[model samples]
Target: MKFLIDAQLPVRLSYLLKSMGHDAIHTKELALKNATPDTEINAISIREQRIVITKDSDFWDSFYVNQEPYKLLLVTTGNISNKELESLFIKNLGQVVDLLEQHSLIEMSRDSVIVHQ
Candidate 1:
């Protein structure tokens, strides 16, 4: 799976995803870097068919209303350190991928993963 890590997420998450054999890129790597606008991010995801992994609710709203971004992983494990966020992601990523096969929107928290159509 291809993934685009949003600015709110650690850049290391992109490397982790790559290490797991997925093609992934962080916003910081792009020309806009961390300042990339949501519209641009949504455009890139559509162009590349990348799954957007973000903590931003804007993407969630857009996905539900516009059905853009191709796919989404909305991280809801609020107020955690980057290390903890990465760890939680690493622990649950496999399930996330599995669920994404059938669901376009996925809400991932520290305790559970919920799939939304």
Candidate 2:
């Protein structure tokens, strides 16, 4: 699947996704800093058909309440180091994919990845 990593996530996570053969883009690559609004990201995700990967809960409003069909991968693991975050994605990307097929939201935490369909 395609993905656009939010500024809150390590930009390098995009590399992890790309390494796994998925199309991915980071905010930096888009020249979008922290100021990029959630709605804008949601729009871009819809336009590009890319899933939105973020740690921010505000995007939930855009994806769920606002009824944005763009896929969402929310990392709710408390503030963590970059390495830890990378490991989480690398280790569980398969399950992540499975969840995505069945749900719009995957709240990836340290212990488990919760799916919200």
- What is the per-residue lDDT of model 1 for residues 1-117, given as tens digits with 9 covering 90 to 100? 999999999999999899998999999999989999999999999999999999999999999889988899999988999789878988999999999888889999989999888
lDDT of 2: 0.85
Q: Can you give the TM-score per candidate against the true fold? A: 0.96, 0.93
Model 1 is weakest, by summed lDDT over 10 consecutive residues, at 81-90
Q: What is the lDDT of residue 12 in candidate 2?
A: 88
- Model 2, 2-117: lDDT tens digits are 89999988888988899999999987777456677777888888899888888888888767777673899888999899999988888999999888887888889998988876
* The best candidate in terms of lDDT: 1
Distance from true location, Cα of 46 in model 2, Å: 0.7
Pick out the ten consecutive residues of candidate 2 with the lowest summed lDDT.
29-38
